[model samples]
Target: MYTELNSILNTTPDSFTQGEFILVSDRQSDASFLMHHFLSFYLRARCKVCFLGLVQSFSHYNAVGQRLGVSLVQAKEKGQLIFFEGLKESLSVLISQESNTKSQAIDFLRDPSVGLRSLYEFVRCTVSSSSGGGEKGADGAEEWGPPVLLVDDLSVLLSLGVTVGTVLDFSHYCRATVCSQLQGNMVMLTRCDGEEEADDGDDEGSERLHRGLTHQCSLTLHVQGLPTGYCRDIHGQVEVCWRRRQGDGQHTQKKLFQYKVHDKGASFFARGTSSAVL
Candidate 1:
């Protein structure tokens, strides 16, 4: 793992500049370790990078928190702060890497060392709202909870007890309502057909869902556990089909994909090529 970290660190900044953030969607066999080592390397290298993970710091705090002087509540806030700080620093690295925001982000992750530098910055600056006045809300409505937009393979917009008119509505709600406010977004989706044999005869149904979504959704983020040849065409608002792969015993659930939509269409992106089309 360290060897891989070294190789990642050795990568040229340009290599990172060419790609977007790679959000690790599924937690594979060594997913946690992979993240741990990747982050350790990034921290050691002082790389600037962002991490999209489930908000589970409270459990860590509750387990061994008495060691710190702060109360459990305070400790929890501190943890959240740490998370946001890391994100901001990664954002900074994204800004500094190149002339454009997107370009620098590519560089920040190109090399493990540079990427770590960014990640460390993010961790250092983030402060949890529990610490103080952190996450803001609309009309003091209490910072909106993470906005969840559930979509099905049939491209049917699954209602999370709500209805969103267009793809942009979903993005804006997720962004302004949640990601921007909470600093993170959560997503869950079913894998493509044949990846895991559908217990029922839903292969054709799921494929239909996936293809039907191509027109309405403009963003597609690539992450772990997805089949090969998967690609999204947000610029043209099209979905590019790729060859399929069988599941290799990975948990593709509970993964989140951060997305942004523009006037032209929806552009899907995540920590990596793992896409989430809007």
Candidate 2:
């Protein structure tokens, strides 16, 4: 992991808590690098991670992962990681010519009415698993750190013909299971309009989903491209928004940082610090 990120979030493997909902939002720039950061970050923390890779294959992630100093292949073998290759599975179902006949994990393609129940079930089962064998604690009791559910992007669900409510409910149920029941965490990646205001061309359903998640999530990280277009020194900027509830009131805290993505990892620096701006 990137200590720079850990400093900004004020979180470390030992200090991180459970029952959190982290929403990673991207406007124009690709934020898959953030996903890689979290995937490796959690793995290093020894948390049971269930990755719903809907946009890319496992091999793609494994390749980026090797540079982060973690072997996803080994993690899968050790049962520390559970992956749901939605991209590959959905493609196979599309080509098989046997879609409309049965209810599968991606029932959205076959019939929108089927919803994402099977997909949620897959996540619930994997994270709640009680299978033996893992690192033990001081008491010698098997310890699997709080489970984490990571979704690469939620817009795909909308693209798949799932309604806004359906996508929200899918995340809601996942939150209920991973955060409430299991005291784990949920990290979702989504997108929205980068303009100061919502754009007419923006996907309304997606915006609704983003709004819904922003309200539900404890933290919102908005990653956006630079205003001047391309920057040799800075890849993009990250806006961190934290939401907290006390008694009957809700409060929020926000921060912004410029960042550069390198091969091994990404670096986060305060605004106006990049050489490109100077």
Candidate 3:
């Protein structure tokens, strides 16, 4: 596929083409490659590009926003201008950009427009800031915007001109936000299955002991330091449990697992999958 795409790209003598440009990013780094390619194509095409695919890092968005002088606050103020009012406006913007021969389509696919709208709804639904519709208290104090995800206290965000609305919107779809704990702690676990055989088998009693179970499970933990602002080592772990064969001719078991997160790396041991609090 790479070779074929390259060949087609090389065959196009004209730098700018009228047809739609589609780029697929299979992984996070692929997104970076896509950005690099779009910039290269944009130079030749000189067209406004509508980005698609996942913008993995807020850093990427910040980089682009800095280039365009568009911050979260600015986006809110220039909402309709940048992202269009809704999906209709978003599609309209893309179509308009597509019409320009010099424009390049750089669609990053988080559905930013949709994400923003959902966030707006969540704010109205959850927190009662401006987006939520409820006014401030009698003292004129207002509820601060979205909670910040940081390794340390994020008072800086407030001074950085980040509003509750912007923070609420940003954190809505952030996986890190969902898993993170107070004081910047986080734990991530994945479930896996494996099979094993008993040492004794063949005998009726042994056969019962050696009967192979088709389904087995294990858990892997990916732990990182809280709010480091980068993927860094962390040190922390809590008890975990696993259960199997519960009720109605099913086996059941549970265990405790501990893990630690450090700046340089992390460590863990496999344990059964039962719910546990550490």
Q: Give the TM-score of candidate 1.
A: 0.26
Q: lDDT tens string, model 2, 1-278?
A: 78789889989987796789999998888888889889998999989899999999999999999999999999898778988888777876778776665336775676887888888888878888732234464556446688999999888888888888888889999999999988888899997755646546555677788888887898889999988788888999999988874543656888999999998888899899876666
Q: Which stretches of candidate 1 lie over 4 Å from their true place?
A: 8-19, 25-30, 48-52, 58-81, 84-278
The 10-residue segment with the lowest total lDDT in model 1? 21-30
Candidate 2, residue 215: lDDT: 79
Q: How many backbone clashes does candidate 2 have?
A: 0
Minimal lDDT window, size 10, model 2: 130-139
Q: Per-residue alpha-carbon lDDT of model 1 for 32-57, expressed as tens digits?
A: 32333333332222222233332334
**Which regions of candidate 2 deviate over 4 angstroms?**
97-103, 130-142, 193-196, 200-203, 245-250, 275-278
lDDT of 3 at 17: 26
Give one digit per residue, the lDDT tens place, for model 3 in 1-278: 12222332342313322222121211111123223333323322222221221223334444544443334334334221112122333354456654444212222113333323443343222222222322445665333322211111111222334343443334333223222321111111111112224323333221121121111121111122222233222222222222233433634333333333222222443332212322
The local lDDT score (0 to 100) that residue 25 gets in candidate 1 is 19
Report the poorest 10 consecutive residues by lDDT, candidate 3: 182-191
Model 2 quality (TM-score): 0.89
Better of 1 and 2 by lDDT: 2
Taking all chains together, each candidate's TM-score versus the true structure is 0.26, 0.89, 0.20
RMSD of 2: 3.7
